[model samples]
Target: MKRWVLTVLFLAVTMSSGLRADSSDQAAAHEIIRAQMQAFQTDDANVAFAFASPELQTKFGSPAVFMDMVKSGYAPVYRPRAVEFRDWVDSPGGPEQQVFVIGPDGRGYIAHYMMERQPDGSWRISGCYLEPLGEESV
Candidate 1:
């Protein structure tokens, strides 16, 4: 009985500490994302592109291509007026992702942006899902 009780107590403490640490890391990632968005809004593509993962950079081939896609594809929704970031979900079986709620002119979308931590300890936006809320699951 004593062994079981101690085991339970130890697990509880360890789990609680882990949860706290995860929450803090999540918060820091959000801050980094907000800054990235600000850079994009200011048309500083270089700064905005700095947040992406190396794999993404190679896949897209060049930072300019990446930025162009972002500007044209979601530009309507992500324009300075409609974009707002909220909610973060560490991707299931994947990296941490963020939710951006965008709306204006009678249209809107919930964008799920996947992010990765850069060498400098900043989160960079790497991938995104531009879709209506609850419309699809993957």
Candidate 2:
């Protein structure tokens, strides 16, 4: 990905890296989300599909069609500028789900991301639940 693209995405992903993940690793995961978001924002189906997990890619197969749905369903409220991972829950068989607070709108977005431990012992994101943080009415 381009440096500016990485810069934009890295801002949000850097938060996830702290204590639990770290700046670099979080940046990488953020890149995935960034690519997906950029695809939706720009209406670029190919770019968006490229960011999907292998499972999703296999299931959908058509980037344009899937991008249409993503644009229609999720492009409205995804203005994420910052992200902070709050809690880490470990399940016996399930992937670790991280609760996060995302800023630029100050809302909650939960990432049920699968983590893979690298040979160096650091964790990188494998997959995640990407959802918009809905606002609560006062």
Candidate 3:
């Protein structure tokens, strides 16, 4: 019923009119993502859930529900064996951070993280699109 699942699961990431992120934005964005990943690693659902946008938070209702959905549908993001920051694109929606990930299954994938800049100037993940890059690590 919501667009986040469909956007991440079914559609391919094809962001256009994007510009590379400046160093400051890149650092901040990457830091938040890495922190979220660490939260997942430690099973801190509340910490991990905080990285999501307010809109997403409301959609899932609670940290537990958000974590469950991520564990099931976003395996790579939830438990990435390896994570590499690729491109930080400034799209119409916001800054779209593309990450290269090695999944728990040992497959390679690209995670397109749609970020939202809060009024306070912090960032949160609004949506994500995961695509299979290859069987081998990239």
Candidate 4:
């Protein structure tokens, strides 16, 4: 009976620790996305580009190019009036978060953002795909 109690206590502590770590990672990922969005709002291309993954930065070549691409292609993301972050899904490739946003025109969009974890234990935006929320009330 004593051994059984000890086993249960150990499992409880281990499970709680794991949950805390997962929650911490989620918070960090959310912050990174929020910071990037703030940068976009301020037209701070360099700060926004810094939140991107190394691969994304390399692909864009420069912050100015990245900002131009975003302004042209992702207008809603570039200037979202409202944003509500949803679930964080774990995948073999990386973690993805779903964000509900209302653009300046009051149209709703679902922004799916993929996040990559750096070797130094920081999260970065690897990619994002936005879908229009058709007829959905914001």
The residue-by-residue lDDT of candidate 4 on 38-87, one tens digit each, is 99999999999999999999999999999999999898889998899887
lDDT tens digits by residue: candidate 1, 1-138 = 999999999999997777667776677767766766777777787777776678777887776787788787866334634555565565773555445454443355667777677787766666776766442222
Per-residue lDDT of 42-115 in model 3, one digit per residue for the tens? 99999999999999999999999999999999999899999989988777887799999999999999999998
Model 1 weakest 10-residue run by lDDT = 97-106
- Model 2: per-residue Cα lDDT over 1-138, one tens digit each: 699998978876775554355445555555555555555557677876766655566676798776665555443323444445444545563435353535344655564555554566544444555555577211
Candidate 1: misplaced stretches above 4 Å? 1-19, 80-84, 104-106, 118-122, 134-138
Tell me the whole-model lDDT of each prediction, alpha carbons only. Answer: 0.66, 0.54, 0.87, 0.90
Q: How accurate is candidate 3 locally (lDDT)?
A: 0.87
**Best-to-worst lDDT order:** 4, 3, 1, 2
Better of 1 and 4 by lDDT: 4
In model 3, the clashing pairs are none
Q: Which stretches of candidate 3 lie over 4 Å from their true place?
A: 1-21, 136-138
Q: For each candidate, what TM-score against the reference?
A: 0.66, 0.48, 0.82, 0.82
Please give the distance, in angstroms, between residue 32's alpha carbon in candidate 2 and its true position after superposition.
Answer: 1.6
Instruction: In candidate 2, list every pair of residues with a backbone clash.
Output: 17-22
